[model samples]
Target: MAKGVWIVAEQRDGALRKVSLELASTARKLADQLGDEVSAVLLGSGVEAMAAELGKYGVDKVYLADNPAFEPYTTDAYAQAITKVVKENDPAVLLLAASAQGKDLAARLVGSLATGMASDCTDVKIVDGKLYCTRPMYAGKCYGEVVVDSFPQMASLRPNVFPLVENAKAGAVVKFEPALGELKTKVVEIQKEASGKIDVTEANIIVSGGRGMKGPENYVILEELAALLGGAVGASRAAVDAGWRPQSDQVGQTGKVVSPNLYIACGISGAIQHLAGMSSSKYIVAINKDPEAPIFQRADYGVVDDLFKVVPALTAEVKKLL
Candidate 1:
């Protein structure tokens, strides 16, 4: 029988990502409820030091697979490595973040293990000794509970939705060698965003714009406000389609899903596609000239005015507060 809770912890450049901690913390909660130990898989070059960090978040053991091939994160290499560790341990529950990398890895792992998986889950809990996952459906119109019947029930949780808690444990390290036979893929190069820019999915607060932004140059105001709040700037599909923002900054069903503590939508009419990406935010504020804009229906707070004027005034007020 499968036992214990397992998480595939994600790291970049030898540093653990915030989602990794969230996964560990969530696994800890589920493991405690099931009276099982929590173990984490850390794959990266020279990431042994990160094992202790996972321990701080309640992981009892860290399965370290340190190799040069794991640094760049090829799907094949990681899939093989994680599948090996999971097969060896036979964990009852497996959790991963729903971020881009996690989603990619989970898809491959599910195929490799021939197990069922729940994707983009907002909440997970132990239900009658089985893993129950809650996920949004039909573009956030409704939610559905999922239960995987296969061994090592798997779920991918949305990043930033789960809380990070510190519950220190032994954090024992168990080194393992991955049998990755001749790989089919290789990383040639990686283009990254400008230094200090945060991904919208990981931001605690987001100031997003849409077609109301007018043009790319007008994003300066949004950027100022976002910088003031120590948050990231996001764009709706309209904004990205209009070439006002990069694809990475787009937030919607066709873009990136974000669940920040606060989401401020500027000049956005609140299309269903856009709502699907950020409807999970704790609080939503919408700014639009039309009172009947679709976005106002979902916003916790609505401002019926031109975003151009509203954004500048809001930025000034924020500056004063700081």
Candidate 2:
């Protein structure tokens, strides 16, 4: 029988991502409930030092695959390494982040391991020693619970939805060497964002714009406010479609799903597609000229006014508080 809870920990540029710690902490809770140990599969070059960090979050063991080929993250290389580990030590439940990389890898693992998986889960709990995952359905209109009956139930959790906890453990390391007989894909170049902007999915606060923004230049105001609040600027699908912002900044069903602590929607009419992405925000504030805008219905606070005037005033108030 599968006995231990496992997580595929993610790291980038030699530092562990916040989602990895979230996965570790969540796995710790589930493992304790099941009376099992929590283990993590860490794959990257020069990432052996990160094992101690995972241990601080209640992971008892780290299966280290320290190989240069693991860096730059090719789907083929990671799938081979992770599949080998899971096959060697069968885990009861496997948890991963719902980020771009996690989603890609989890899909491949499901095919290779022949197990069931829940994608982009917002919540997960162990009921009767089984994993029950909660995920949004039909553009956030409803939620459904998922259970994978197969051994080593897999789930990819959404980023920032789960809390991080520190529970120290032994953090023992077990080195594993994967026989990767690969020759399929190669990382030629990686183009990174020049502005070092925060991803909306992982941000605590988001100040977003839409058609009311008028033009891309007006986004500077939102950026100023976001900088002051240590948040990020997001755009609606309309803004992205109009070329006012990059697709990466878009928040909607066709774009990225965000669950920030606070979401400030400016000038956006709140189309169902857009609402489907960010409706799960803890607090939503909508500023629009039209009082009947659909976004007002979902916003916790609604301001019936022009966003051009409202955003500047709001920025001033934030500056005063700072």
Candidate 3:
């Protein structure tokens, strides 16, 4: 029977992503609630050192699945390796970040194990002795508590919603060997996006723009503010669909979910679809001309004014502080 909570640690370029640590921190909370141990599954080539970081977040054990073929993210390779680990350990709960790689892995895991999974969960906890997960539905207009009838309940949590917590743990590292399988798909090319800017998921402050910005060219002001603050830039679906920003920068129901300490929505109308993605942020600031905009309802601070005039002034003020 599954006993402890397990976190699937994500690594890229031999470095563990912040989501991995965040998920481990979240797993620690759930494990404490259930009086269960928190374990981690780290898979990659020469990634044994990454396991030590998980131990800092209260992990009881780190199951290392090291392999040369696992250097980069390949769906077939990762799924097969993770499946092997799950079958062997049978963890009580499996937590992963709802990232593109994570979503693909979760779906593959569900197919392999024939188990139910809740995707892009916003909240998770044990309720009445069963794992209850809260997820947005109908484009964030509604929410529901989901229960998976599988032994090892699986859920992919949205990034940034959970804070990374640190706790001392003498986690024992256990190396695991998986039965090798033939690669079904080959990665011939990898086009990496220019990402020197702050990662949105890891940013402490985020300033997002929407249709109210009018055009793609108008995003310069938003970018300036974000750069000054050392924050990441985000966009609404409308702005993204208009080709103002890359799809990766979009933050809404059909885009990335982020929870930062400060989320500044500039010119965004605050549709429920968009709110579903960022309502969990610690503090929200909305800037829109319409005083009655829906986003103002959720914002901790609301500025009723034209973004064109207000944003530049705000940027200047921020620049002065710098």
The order by descending TM-score is 1, 2, 3
lDDT of 2 by residue, 1-322 (tens): 8889999999987799999999999999999999999999999999989999999999999999888899889889999999989988999999999888999999999998899999999999999989999999998888999999997899999888889999999789999999998649999999887666888887999999999999999999999999998999999988999999999999988999888999999999999999988998999999999999999999999999988899899999988998
Clashing pairs for predicted structure model 1, backbone only: none
Give TM-scores for every candidate, taking all chains together and pairing residue i with residue i: 0.98, 0.97, 0.94
Higher-lDDT candidate of 1 and 2: 1
Candidate 2 clash pair list: none
> Worst lDDT window (10 residues) for model 3?
193-202
Candidate 2 Cα deviation (angstroms), residue 95: 0.6
Candidate 1 Cα misplacement greater than 4 A, ranges? none
State each model's C-alpha RMSD to the native: 0.9, 1.1, 1.7
Name the lDDT value of residue 132 in candidate 2.
98
lDDT of 3: 0.87
- In model 3, what lDDT does residue 187 have? 85
